[model samples]
Each structure stands twice: as structure tokens, then as C-alpha cells.
Target: MTTASPRWFKSSYSGTTSNCVEVAINLVASHGTVPVRDSKVSDGPSFSVSASAFSSFVAGVKGGRLGV
Candidate 1:
């Protein structure tokens, strides 16, 4: 089967810096997971996390629980 590619984007909170990761929100609905990768490494390895887990991680970051 042909797989769909994840559309990755950096977080809005990320300023002009290389220390940032890109996340593909599109995959959450179709794949039930979120693909993540380093913004500086476009051709590098990527990893996926469950949608719920990714959501929790984002919530923690927004709530300062992740200490981001």
C-alpha cells in the first residue's frame, strides 16, 4: 500500500532558532499518531507517538508541566 506522507511544521512558539522540532498534525486523524522530527534535520530519522500521547505532551508543555 502507498503510505501518505506527514506534513511537518515547526511550533509557532519556536523563535528564530535551530533548537526546534517539527510535528505532523495531519497524521493524527488518519494514522492515529503524530510524526515528529528535528527541524534542522529534514532527511533525518523521524518517530511517531500516539495522538493521545502527543496531545498530553502538548498539554503538559502549555501547562508548564513539561518544563519546556
Candidate 2:
């Protein structure tokens, strides 16, 4: 088994806002989930969503269906 960990990153589109979220997709292939966390809170709690669900959410955002 592979020993993997989240590799978090924030979008460049986030600009300089302190209110941002980071996501780690590195584990998705093995874990089947995407981990997300607040950029301001590195040690804070993070949550995971199914890869399919995360993909849908991204699509919605890209299509402007999520109001950005």
C-alpha cells in the first residue's frame, strides 16, 4: 500500500484574500475523495468529498451555476 498525504493548494484566482480554501487532489486516485480545508487554518479540521461530487461542483462553478 502507498503511504500518501494531502498536498494542499489554493487557486491563483483566489487573489490576496485571507478567505480562501485549499484542496488536495493527490490522494484522489487511491482514496477516491478530495480533501478541502481553510487556507487560514492549516491545522484546522478538513473535510473530504467524493471525487465525482467534487468534479460536479467544479463544473457548476465553471459554468457559473454556483454564482461563483
Candidate 3:
């Protein structure tokens, strides 16, 4: 997939620093996995995930379910 098509989004929580990460969402023909990448490296590597896995991740994050 072309890097141009992925829409990168920044977290609402950010600090006053030059260093920050961005998430790119690429929902294409791959129906299950959600592609995520760093904004600094648009052409860099990315991680893939199933839709259910992604949801669980978000839920854990919001609910502090990770036990971190």
C-alpha cells in the first residue's frame, strides 16, 4: 500500500517536545488487521493486528486493564 493513503493521527495527549509518535490507520483489502506506524517514519515498518485484538487493546488501555 502507498504511504499517501494512510491517515496519520496524533494522540490527544502530547507534551511540548520535538519527540512524539503518530499512528497511521490503514484499513484496506486486509479486513482483519489494522496497520499502525510512526508519523516520523511514514515509509518505515508497521504493525498489523486483528480488529478484535485492536479493540481489546483499546479497552485495556482505557480501563487500565493491562495491569500496568
Candidate 4:
């Protein structure tokens, strides 16, 4: 098991808002998970989804399948 910490970052398309979603894709290779959290609540609850699931979610968002 890797002891690496998450390196979180928000999308560049999020503009200057502090309320955007943040993701840590760094864990995908080591843990098979993509951690996600709200930028506005840095110390709040966060969740992790499978790497494949996160990739699908991103594809849906980019393809406008989720209706933006």
C-alpha cells in the first residue's frame, strides 16, 4: 500500500470560484480510487469513487450527457 497523500485540484474551467469541486486523481494508480470533495468545505466530508467510475463521470460531463 502506498502512503502518498492526495494532491487535490479543481478544474481550470471552474473560474475563480471557491465553491467548485476538487478531485485527487493521484490515488487512482495506487488505490484505484479518485477522491472528491467540495472546495468550499475543505475540511468537510469527502468521498472516493472508483477510477473507472470517475472517468465515466468526467466523460459524461464533457459530452454533456449529464446535461451540464
Best by lDDT: 2
- Write down the TM-score for model 1: 0.87
Model 4 spans > 4 angstroms off: none
| Candidates arranged by TM-score, highest first | 4, 2, 1, 3
Tens-digit lDDT track of model 2 for 1-68? 77898999999999999699999999899999999999999999999999999999999988899864
TM-score of every prediction relative to native = 0.87, 0.91, 0.64, 0.92
lDDT of 3 by residue, 1-68 (tens): 33345566667776554355655455634455566766567677877777678778989999998989
lDDT by residue for model 4 over 1-68, one digit each (tens)?
Answer: 68999999999988998979999999999999999999999998889999999999989988999974
User: Whole-model lDDT, candidate 1?
Assistant: 0.89
Q: Candidate 2 lDDT (Cα, whole model)?
A: 0.94
lDDT score of residue 34 within candidate 1: 95
Q: Is candidate 3 or candidate 4 better by TM-score?
A: 4
The TM-score, computed over Cα atoms with residue i paired to residue i, of candidate 4 is 0.92
Among these predictions, the greatest TM-score belongs to 4
* Model 1: worst 10 consecutive residues (lDDT sum): 1-10
lDDT of all predictions? 0.89, 0.94, 0.65, 0.93
